[model samples]
Target: MFDTWSVRELANADHPPSVPLNPMGALPCIARLEDETGSSWWVAATANRWTTTHVLVLWRPDPRNHRQERLVWLRKADVRPWLHKEQATRT
Candidate 1:
């Protein structure tokens, strides 16, 4: 299942209760997020547990840098489900 909402909607909505970190002190969840720009991202909760404002995302690697994995931070509110018409039809 996916949480389908826009950044603006998430900002105006109430947040869910804080989720507990795993024993290793990480938020153990992965989500497929879509931004307002229509870009899709696969993100994992970062090791930083001091705040709930941002998440770490694996960036699309360039062909020349295939051996490297690029990570970046994105606002939590900007993360939303990647919905498509085809997916809806199948469901």
Candidate 2:
């Protein structure tokens, strides 16, 4: 996604980011999904915006500096079928 990526480090004097300049460039991202069969599927997708099914974020604060670190993002989905399958397993 356009917003999911950033420069890992300052690669140039101008500090240009590694993100592609193309508006339709594929997002530098990946996803891992596990089904009821205990098999996992890795999904590859392109994006120009952040998708709930493509990412998530968690944040923690730095107690020493009293400042919070950047949010962490994860890729997951809220598929109804998956929910039902999980519920079935519990029962």
User: What C-alpha lDDT values do all the predictions have?
Assistant: 0.42, 0.31
TM-score to native of every candidate shown? 0.30, 0.24
- What is candidate 1's lDDT per residue for 8-60, written digit by digit as tens? 32222223355335333434344454545665555442232323765544432
Cα misplacement distance, residue 17 of candidate 2 (Å): 31
Clashing pairs in 2: 56-73, 56-74, 57-72, 58-72
Candidate 2 wrongly placed segments (more than 4 Å): 1-26, 47-91
lDDT of 1: 0.42
Task: Tell me model 2's lDDT, rounded to 2 decimals.
Answer: 0.31
lDDT score of residue 39 within candidate 2: 46
Off by over 4 Å in 1: 1-52, 61-65, 84-86
Q: Score candidate 1 by TM-score against the native.
A: 0.30
Residue-pair clashes per prediction, in order, are 0, 4
